[model samples]
Target: MNEHYNRWLHHRGLDPDLMQELLLLSQDEIEDCFYRHLDFGTAGMRGLLGPGINRMNLYTVRRVTEGLARTLIAQGDDTRKRGVAIAYDSRRFSPEFGAEAAGTLASHSVRVYLYPSLRPTPMLSYAVRHLGAAAGIMITASHNPASYNGYKVYGSDGAQMPPHRVDKILQALAGIDELALPSHSLQDGIASGWIKEIGSEVDTAYYNHVLSLSHENNATANQQLKVIFTPLHGTGNRPVRHILGELGFTQVHTVSAQETPDPDFPTVSAPNPEEHDVFTLALTEAEQYTADIVIGTDPDADRLGLYARNPAGNYTAFNGNQIGALLLHYTLERKAAKGELSSQGIVLKSIVTSEMGRSIASSFGVKMEDTLTGFKYIAEKVDRYEALNTPFLFGYEESYGYLLGSFVRDKDAIQAAMMCCEMAAYYKQAQNLTLTEVLEILYQQHGAYIESIFSFTFQGKKGLEKMSTLMDTLRNQPLKQIADLPIAQVKDYRLGIDHLPKANVLKYLCTDNSWVAIRPSGTEPKIKFYISAVADIIDAAQEKKKRMEKDLRDRLETSL
Candidate 1:
């Protein structure tokens, strides 16, 4: 075994002070932990918190931050002078990780604006742009379980750092052979003004921006609109409720048990808004209040989930695609009705997202653009449109993430929450319809667009190799048919020759308007298969989706 791996194993066997604190770990765990350093991908570093090179310990955090500091210094005096903003979520070691990052930056004489308490990911993005910081760091694992944590970096534009800059950050990280930082204290940095504490002022500013998005003039006008909201035990509680109250959502009900931040996320297994089971608490409350709508944001509050009453009176969670289409249609339709629709307006969605958004945008004479799978790509598109003097009307991904008005470069669940409420209220007034009804109307007008995502986990080194091999195999041998339907073309994003920038992905377009995409997860050790199909009627779409899913399963079984 390598020296580092042996050290990890020795540490595991000793039952020493540090080892005990990290909980029970086996030899295999030690090997996996020390095998390699956590990767710094397009999003940044993420891994389980433990005492290994591959783990998210203080040493790894410092090394990454030192590298970031070096990159900032290389940019020149102005960039270093502007510094970086830092925030943490309510997770184990999150605050410590934030402090370590700040101290590393301070060692290089870079200013840091660290949040006084836990803050959402979107707020960190906002603070970066609001403070004119050179970059930003948010210590969070998002909706992951308690065993995981992560680091997300943002650029000056407040979007997740783009691939080009992230590559530079990785290069700088490699330049530092040692993980230790020079003698420096985060407290001392704060005392010397190199680090500043951000608090309610920024929160108040962000809440004000959310309130400005409200189209409801009379708070009492929508008082009858009963709403239930849950933060899923993350950082969205304060802002989501504050904005709802400010917008005069009188009957806004909170999932009382889940309103507080808990690092353990005791209520749910994953704390993800995309999961139907995570709404257990909110659904229970919704039942009591007879709520018109149920909304949930994940741990970091960048993604939003919606649930509405069906004609049968049972609440059903709307998938990300359904919500995205509704929001796009509503935003444009309202703009047109108010005579605010501009010729320069545009909508952006990830390439993997539902194409129903395109139909909605086209109905209003707005241009729709597709990017790679990350919100950063969507933000980049927004930046491009802004430079061209065009307007950004809306943007979204298939993972329950949405953005409106571009005030915040990343996904803003707070904005999505408010807009969804407004859309629900508008439908209520205009057609006496609920969100579910709005979706039915959309299905009737446009072809029904159905999408499903399947994830296969491949853990450890061997699993990683297997995942790469699988991607290569798919690239080398493309699928000609799925469920007897002919595939028209294949899109290989990894080859860097696509409609958008290159990524490590393959998309197969089928003759029957069905498609399947394969890509590695940016934040986890897994691969995701996204299947989408569109048809003139809901029954046809449902039937096609069934066949496609069965074929995909059979193929994966045989190929893997």
Candidate 2:
């Protein structure tokens, strides 16, 4: 074991107070805690809250912030003067982590604009650009469970720091000799003007930007278009509800059980909007109100999930791909109808996201670009497009993240919520069709696009080794066919040399319009398999989907 891990173990076992707590934990639990330092990846740091070197606590947050501060100082005096913006979600110790980060930056004579209270991740991204800060920090684990918390660093462009710069940050982190809590108080730092508290004004600016995305002014105050919303016990409750009310959405019902920001997230096992369990309360309320649409945002409100009512009154969640495709088509059609579709208008999506978005973009003659998985890549593309005078129309990923305007660099669930409501209304008013009906129309026009995501979780050191072995096996041996489709092309992002601009990923293109991409999650210890197929008819699409899913599962089982 490393010296740090040994010290941590000794502290837990020898310290009387700690021993009392340690006695309750199993051997496996203790081992897990002291196994290794929580990884500080390109996305920054994330882990469970504890006293070990591997945990997320004031000391670890300070260490990372110190590194960021040093990196800024090295850039120049002007960069340091520009400072960093900080925000936190409603997780346990999130506020403390935000304060710790701010105090650490202040100790290095860097200015900090910490949010007055918990704020969404998009707000932190927006504040970075809005204040012209050198960088930004958001203390959130996003959709992770309540036990977990994280620190995400953003660049001056208002996007998460790119991978190349993250390497530099890691190098700086390595140079720090001692990882200890800062001596100075964040409250004192604020009093001395080194740390500033920001609120309402930023909220107004963000809300105004969201309102500007509306295409039509005639929003009929209809109770029949009932909408139900839940924040999943996170920071989105006030902002999402307030935005919906202001947008003339009259019969908007809030999930009372989950309308408050509770770090414990007592209502569900996990606060992730991607999980169906988090929607139990909201779905129940939706049925009672006969809501036309149901929407929920994750802890930091960076991702949005939607459920639409079918003709049989059965409510079903729409996956990220479907939502992305719908938003792309709706935004383009409206822009063209208003004669506002510019020659320079552009749409962005992750490489693993549904290609149906690309097809929709093509139909409107709008440029569509694909970035790597993270929203940071999408934000970087937006920054590049804006610098070149290209108008960014929309950007999304397959993980329930979507961004509408350039006001916020990362995904904004508040904006996505409002836009989805508007899209649902437009579809209803124009064609007397539901959002699902519009989706079917999209399938008929452009061949039906079916996509699915499969994730395999691996934990601890052995799990990491297993994950690496699996990736190596897949890379060395290619699949000849999947579900009767001959594999025609293979894209290995890990062999960055092969692709020139390398990424750690592998993609296979079958002879048919079906494709599969395999890549490890940057923020989590899991490998994701993305399968997509496009067929001429609905029946063919269904058949191909079943076969592809079965083949992928079979291969994954054997390989594992």
Candidate 3:
């Protein structure tokens, strides 16, 4: 640790602010910062912003980017000439980091296409496909706290890079030296044509593609419907609002406080749409506008949160499972009615997602598929569907990520927000129903499917060891029941069951189709417990879900 600290201390290019910060660190802080070198995993690197080998800073970004440059060059001349696309969110140093990545690639003689301003991660995915780039980099942490930032890599297919490719990059990365890395100036890269700035052309192309996904040309009847939208101080403001306006929902109201991009994310505790508290400001605006629905997108606009007016004249937030079920029902029903639905059509979801999606798919005579957690897996299945000439109707996860169609290979909040508005508008005008009412009807048709996620954060080095111990305990001693319901099966993903890739996840399935899944977060310091309970009635389902969560938490606590 001292060796690393001394090396960093003497590095000439270290930023002055970082140098001052490093100079004041206590011994423990220094150890924390230099204990181990940061590992570049398949998800790329994510960490709190700081001046350390283990933190996110210029040295770390350059080191991994240097690896990416080498990997791209090794792919041969054509791939290198195809270049890389770069985009960023409105986070602190996002644009700077993006420019740094571009310069690093250019330094290695790799071509680059870079977005001129902040854009959603989905747009980055779209840009990669639209431009035929070999890979892409997005320089923002999705929904993490203001202190956090990250770099995510995407493949030529516009999805997060698969493990095999990432493994090769890791191998190249291991041989690179951070301080000794070389970089070209962003100015020089552009002057010499090694880097090109891209904006309106890609945005227009992506917008047109998104508009094509709507099921109808007749959104006129619902033009009067009131809607509320918030970007949560991220990048969705323009794209989402533009689509909604183009679709004739001109009465849309933006949460004034969160209308513009703010790197500090000052209005909320955190910028995550998955958290209920993040919706406080939006809900307040919803009531003021008497909005039929309230929508919010995370910092990168990759995840969405929703609320709708209920019959009781109050706003209610639906969990990811419920929202996903609603979207699936709306999409499948519309397609089936129009005779566009095919037997070969499929819906993809994570293994941890609600089985209610499967129930909906079965009713429509379509196949339902399950992948491991990340959107990349869903994207992979989309590739398979294309190879087989089947259609991908929809894909979603309980983390509030949803993708419709194949134009964008990752979860797209802009696409989701548009579809959500279209669905709400159609039902509001034609069916005389609220989103809450439609959700209840779906529950009535399919048995009530209730779900919730419990997340436990374990921080620091010791916390990591403790998390490993917890997973080991769960694997060695299986639970037979929770809340008196017998576990009919245990699916341990680490063993690669169900023909899926090996992952560190354990799912317990009850005979009643109720389930609980345990898995650690790949990018954050937390483990999540997903509980799904089904019953004939919503109240009973809710009660069962609550009891199961309590029992599971108690068991996990004792195990620790």
Maximum-lDDT candidate: 3
After superposition, the stretches of candidate 1 with alpha carbons farther than 4 Å from their true spots are 6-24, 175-179
- lDDT string for model 2 (1-560, tens) is 44564554455224354445545656566677667667765366788776655778766777778889889999999998899999999999999889888988988889988898999999899899889999999999988888889999999989999888887887888746334444467978887788988878987987788788887545683334689999988888888877777778878888989988999999999888778888998998888888889999999999999999877789878889999888888888998999999967989888789888888898888888888878888898899889999999999999999999998999999889988888887777777888888888999999888888888999866788898999888888888888899999888876663323477788888887689899888777888889898798768877888898888888788778
> Whose TM-score is higher: candidate 1's or candidate 3's?
3
Candidate 2 Cα RMSD (Å):
2.3
The numbered model that scores best in TM-score is: 3
Whole-model lDDT per candidate: 0.86, 0.84, 0.89
lDDT of 1 by residue, 135-218 (tens): 999998887788999999999999998888888988987746433345367888987779988877888888777777665545
**Model 2 regions lying over 4 Å from their true place:** 9-31, 221-224, 497-500
Q: List the residue pairs that clash in candidate 2.
A: 493-503, 493-505, 494-505, 496-502
Report the error of model 2 at residue 440, Å: 0.6
Model 1, residue 204: C-alpha shift (Å): 2.2
Ranked by TM-score, top first: 3, 1, 2
The residue-by-residue lDDT of candidate 3 on 425-509, one tens digit each, is 8888888899999988888988999999998899877777888988898899988998879999999999988999999999999
Cα lDDT of model 3 overall? 0.89
lDDT: which is higher, 1 or 3? 3
